[model samples]
Target chain A: MYGNSQFDGSAAFSGGGFMPSQAIPTADPSSPAKSREAQGLLPLTVKQIREVFQASDDKANFLIDGVSVNNVKLVGLLFEKTERVTDVSFVLDDGTGRIDCHRWVQESLDTKEMELLSNGTYIKVHGHLKGFQGVKQLVVYSVRRITDYNEIPNHVAECIYVHCYNTRTRKMQDAPQATGQLPNPAVNTPSKGYQPTSSNHSQFSVQPIVDGMKGIDKIVLNYIEQPSCIGKENGIHRAELAKQLNVPEHKIMEAISSLESEGLIYATVDEFHFKSTVNG
Target chain B: MDTSNPAAFVNAELLRMYVGRRVRAVIQVLRNDGGSIFGKSTDEQELVVKGHPPNPPTTFVEVIGIADSNRSIQAEIWTNFGDNFDVSSYNTICQLANGDFKHLFI
Candidate 1:
């Protein structure tokens, strides 16, 4: 339940991971071209960055959690600051692990930005990941000191969010094959219609869905499916549900009606109350 | 210093799990007495931080060191996290790093 969870938005966060990775058409002949295309900036912790492996044949590509990653970002304490004639480097630690990050001073702006960092200051680094003789380091493109402390936790949450979105969704995609269930085409047809056009990670990060329904519809359904909500005589009233979710009365009504039509939920006591059709 | 073992993020509760091991935490300074700091953990539990305070004492400080005891940390590295910080958010990070998302961290 959201009440005792570490993050109130974690339900929404995990929902993003449920989007079928197969939604992206992989059958296209342009597999190599698609793989070469730029991936969205991946938010990762230093520990996860260390776990990434370089592609066997190509030195350019990197993979984390069995998926390719690019343009990674992290927030950490700037522990060691080194300024050289050609480039400036820093050792950043975000508690999980430490990583060496460097930015080439190609112009005055680069030097100016790098000068703003000092040891013990928290900074956000946006850069590419590179492996130098089997050691991983971040090739810093942009670095900014974190003035607002909230960015620290926000970065951690984002890392976990992307981690789940990449790894969990991939597991779900591979689950049927691993279990010897060779592609249930009958059940997969309807879910294909709901796939988004863009495969960008950030686009679907907040859009949590349930049984092809989204937004308030999904939230209401999930709330009713909670262990406590099942098998109740009257179930939960629309007024109580709306009050609990802090949504307007009409929006709850809309979600209930939509969910009812989809057969995910049914009217239990009169038209105003509802419960999930799935049993306890 | 080959990183076979690394410091983990810990709050007051998790610090107990890492006794005599390396850990890191953000503490809101309650009192500073030159060599030692009396601070409150992100989870709002009191902790003694054994380290030198930064010049012009920051309200929030992150200490990376060994968890000496459940209620104390022996600081090796000190970072000034400025006067204002979102303690609740930091608390959430502590929970996630040690809880459901533990594998993502060291």
Candidate 2:
């Protein structure tokens, strides 16, 4: 291996099964071709992993929470109760559950980083999901050490957003199609301020509140429709909105702004306090 | 971390990981070439083995050897010689795409 001494750790990978390719070097099993798919990756708890085991039709293809998982990613703390193999085997726990993660080779062993990978340390695992003998395990591609504890909660929140966005979009498309009309009839029209969709027009009949609205806007309308938020008389506060959807305050403000401009939600007491037109 | 370098391709590192470890992976023997047997993974990547194991594709094979790259592996395959592969160790190969978009799951 005629190479620079700076890449000393790189040699460890080539020792057993690999011979440094004079032709072309394939870095790790993770390839560039797969990354083009931007949608559908989920961050899951151990309890949710059981769904993948039941959902996978075969070992090669699998789904988690009805979303087709090309590669399953998860964040969790290391659990050390499991048996160890040379350069393989890591059991992870994210409080909701625990699962085994295996690597084909040992990358960082007998090092401070390996020591730091002890029980209870948070790690972000990007890997392929595998099921063996009715149990699921992750055939890890790469494992990153998580420095910040907040990343754990953020990871879960992002997964919820992605899943919610996908499902809501699917539901929106389905609602229009149920009326036996062309889907997305609003394509050609510019809203002169909250135009009711032609397909939904007959369905809503007397109620304009069931008009053509985006997912988050519809959810906000529903939130105001709730007794607790509406019972406040002044309406739900801004801080409560940011907390409920688990989004930033600014994002909630944006949605609220659009809803107000569309004449859907109206301010009651202050800018943050809002009541939907239908709820009133 | 370096994406420009072809050597930094993820499959290359994967080859290094599988070396010497006995993995029960699902493999399809595309063709057997006398002393050398060539196979295909479920991910549709090429798998080359220097030694012979069994006939038929889409079956389980017990493999232990070295990985030259993610696509090219030199495995001493142990076939189940039955309709199914091994229960405990068959490698169920899958190509994963990470959210960061930086990870290349081949």
Q: Rate the local accuracy (lDDT) of all candidates.
A: 0.72, 0.50
Docking class of 1: acceptable
Docking class of 2: incorrect
TM-score of chain B in each prediction: 0.93, 0.47
Q: Candidate 1, after superposition: displacement of residue B55 in Å?
A: 3.3
Could you say which candidate leads in DockQ? 1
| DockQ value for model 2 | 0.01
Which whole-number lDDT from 0 to 100 does residue A247 have in model 1?
95
For model 1 chain A, give the 10-residue run with minimal summed lDDT: A176-185
Query: lDDT tens digits, residues B68-101, model 1?
Result: 9999999998878888888888888889888999
The sequence of per-residue lDDT tens digits that candidate 1 reaches over residues A1-280 is 6778575584565334623232222444544233323334678887777777776634456777656655678887787799999999888877777888888898999999988877878889988777667777777788998888778778888788666655655565553211111111222222221222243321132133353466899889878877688758778899999999999999999999877765557888699888866544
Q: lDDT per residue, candidate 2, A82-201, as tens digits?
A: 434555577875434567887655555423334556665568987766667776788765677875434543565555444444444445555532212111112222132133334344
Q: RMSD in angstroms, all models? A: 13.9, 22.0
